[model samples]
Target: MQDFNGQIAFITGGASGAGLGQAQVFGRAGARIVIADVRAEAIETALAALAGEGITAHGIVLDIMDREAYARAADEVEQVFGAPPTLLFNTAGVNSFGPVEKTTYADFDWIVGVNLGGVINGMVTFVPRMIAAGKPGHIVTVSSMGGLQGSAIAAPYSAAKAAVVNLMESYRAGLAQYGIGVSVVCPANIKTNIAEASRLRPAQFAGSGYVENEASIASLHSIHAHGMEPIELAEHVKAAIEQNQLYVIPYPEAKEQLRRHYDEIVDAVLPMEADPEGARKRTEALRNWAADRARVFQKSEG
Candidate 1:
């Protein structure tokens, strides 16, 4: 995973933003780029931009939610470029702002379908092929800082991103034995068209029931307006891949917050009062409850 030259990369949502930034970095490193996006025009535009940079690239129209389309895109890349792509980026995502109580079923479905399900689809379709090829490769899943911490206002986005973060962790642990590296990016804020480019809410959620309230939307917009450049975050991703790092955190300030949060958890665990009888009873009850819960939850999938 250290070297990318002459390798092939398949990037979802590569038409713009951080996805395009990753594509640019890979291309600059002499990698063959396959930019997949739902917007045909945007893909063409990205192709033109890459071409202008003298990069070898191709554009494939892809809606990551469509499993068939994802498979076909992977097949096409292999047919044209030889072996399966070595670098796979699951970067397509959307944002929803609002309170959890106001959120509707459709809102949850759309966000989860695009963010979490899309990442799952990409991994399923590409990881096995890469492992079979027996080549060094990396899977980069673009999660958000919101994924790391539950943001009160953006419940749907936070839920989806949290799922992505955990999924990447599981994927990394599972793939490590196969020599396939995985990196999960927890970006705090980066300048992108996420808000403007987000898909419209379904009619079922559009009126009042939508999770994103006006205040929260305004807050997100303000943050977006002041976010980092996409390329800067992309460089961080490239550096993480080069270093074989599992977590790629782009914002330094946000890292401090994360560190503080972890410290608080550690502190909370360290100050235990001596209470043998109470502790034993509590532990046994907790273990029993967990055992019961696991039996019921065993059949469910994340």
Candidate 2:
């Protein structure tokens, strides 16, 4: 929506990084901010920072992987704000890097739980409420540039983020009927602390933490420390939300990378003879199958 004035924004991972950036921008635009994060100390700091700027903000300690906790947080948001949030941000995420074969199951769980599960939990908990409110709203899920391409070292992170991209596409198609806009942000590197995500790994996943790749980790940290400012990315997100844009990519180089990746996939597909009749028959069969399986979303605006 063009107007964010008086809207309530519920942002996961809002304590820091890109989420915090969004809070800053949306708050300046007159939206009440709700910062949900697992780190209690960080939440305190973020809330204070917002308060210093005269932005109305609330903080809730949240671990997005816990579905019960998410439900409670939603209740708390409504309790505090007197209504459900209209702007939802599924931006909480973490990163880990290692050889694919060497990565442990715990690694998969930890990475997937925070990156992909966080987005799913946010959608499951908030989308229905936003729908019921029958007000214009928007959902933004932060994937990554890596999600658009594969990486040998960060396979788990890439896989989880890639799934987020696909999930948001489905939500966009379904939620459009209700006028709830959806945007999947695939941002490139930015100045954030995500490189140090291993610090918060649960005890259960300790053994699966980043392998002995200090040099690589150091290189990545250096890049992230000097990357684009969060406020710049925040500006892009604001514009995207205003325009109801589906994809938000702030980095210039990422476009070329996406092009190459998609080009490779397109080139790799096996070619067959062009047959209009055969294609029409296949299309009809697909439609029948979708109808039979109840795989299509059918909803009409009132």
Candidate 3:
């Protein structure tokens, strides 16, 4: 949105890392901030830090995975701000390292459950409320570069993030008519506490296939230590929202690698230029089907 003054920004995982960075950047630009997270201590700490900066921020203890809790949190925001948040951020995520073959159902449940399921919950819970309010707004989800290029190191994390990338694209197309802008940020490494995400893992998901020791955590921390600062990342995100940009990827260092990967994908696909009749038939068929199933599909234009 072009304006931010007096806008309510509800940020998931707002206690630390990327979420906190958004709270700082957006709050400084005159938006009221809500820091929702699972850790009560972190929420208080984040609130105090924002208080020192004279930023208008409130804290809500939340576990985004719980659909009921997410609904309650939405209600809480309405009660506190007397309105729905115009700026919704789905930024909470988790990661773990293990061989894909060794990864268990539990691993997928915890990692994907938080990473993807949480975003789904947020979208379902808030979209209706925001639409009912009939205000121009924006929704931003934090994905990862691994989402674009799959990672053997963290398969579940990569898979969930990849889904997030596609999900935002669909939302962008669907929400555009409602004056709601949607953007997905596919970031590389960032200086954050995600390395210690294991510490926050609930006991119900304790059965893990990956090793979660100090050494592994430290290794992740060291890699992230050399990564981009959260505030700087937030600056890129702010610009993307203002520009209505679809992809918020600021890592130029990754250009050559991504280009190479995309090239391979293109090489694998059969060029439509060589099969004009087939392409025309396929397009016509889809258009006819979409027209027949109008209620099930968005209308396509000439």
Candidate 4:
């Protein structure tokens, strides 16, 4: 995992922003890059930029939300590269601010579809191919600091980003047997084009509860203007991948904030001292069930 030399990296949203940063960083480190994105023009631009640096890269126009298209992209990767990518970057995402209560199904479908669903599609499509290749690999997913806590203004966005963190956590253990590493990058804010995600909303998902306008999108720039640069953030991600580290939250304030947020949940738990016997019995029952399940699985495998 420490070496990315000649490794194939398939990155979604690779046309611009964070994804493009990853492409540049990883490609520079000797990884063959595949820039997968929905925008053909942007993909061309990205490929050209990578080429100017003499980085080995290919561009694939893909809508990660489309499962069939995702599968085809997977096929295209294998056909073009002669192998599945050793590194998969599920970096595409979208966000729109709206009152939590006013959030529409379309909003969830679009926001969650890209942020969460796209990650799922990438996992489903690539994990099997990566596994079958029988090569060690790494999967890095881009979540947000908003994911660690709920947000009234961007409920669905937060929820979806949160789900990706959980998703990578689960994959970490499961994929370990296959020599695959998983890392979730929960960044606070970045100088990226994500704020303009609303403009990409499709007609099928036009029933948005949030206001989508130039002014609203423009307002986000002020907030993210002082954010970290994408290439600089990508350096942190590269180090995490090499080290097989989990939970890449680089923001200094995040530790204290997450501590306060998680502390509340921890405090809400009823202490075992309150009902020692009940807790003992519940723990025993779960252990017995798990023991039996393990035996059953072993027998089946045997």
lDDT of 3 by residue, 1-302 (tens): 88889999999999999999999999999999999999999999999999999999989999999999998999999999999999999998999998988898889999999999999999999999999999999999999999998888789999999999999999999899999999999899988999999988888998899999999999999999988988999999999999999899999999999999999999998888999999999999999987788755545542
Backbone clash pairs for candidate 1 read 97-212, 98-211, 98-212, 98-213
Tell me the whole-model lDDT of each prediction, alpha carbons only.
0.84, 0.90, 0.93, 0.93
Residue-level error in angstroms, candidate 1, position 165: 1.4
- Show where candidate 3 strays beyond 4 Å: 295-302
What is the alpha-carbon lDDT of model 2 when measured against the actual structure? 0.90
> TM-score for every candidate vs. truth?
0.84, 0.93, 0.96, 0.97
Which has the greatest TM-score?
4
Once fitted onto the true fold, the runs of candidate 2 whose alpha carbons sit more than 4 angstroms away are: 212-218, 270-277, 290-302
Candidate 1 accuracy as lDDT: 0.84
Q: Clashing residue pairs, candidate 4? A: none
Residue 50 lDDT, candidate 2, scale 0-100: 98
Q: TM-score-based ranking, best first?
A: 4, 3, 2, 1
lDDT of candidate 1 at residue 80, scale 0 to 100: 91
In Å, residue 62's CA in model 4 sits off its true spot by 1.0
Error of 3 at 294 (Å): 3.8
lDDT of 4 by residue, 50-75 (tens): 99999999999998889999999989
| Root-mean-square deviation per candidate | 5.3, 2.5, 2.4, 1.2
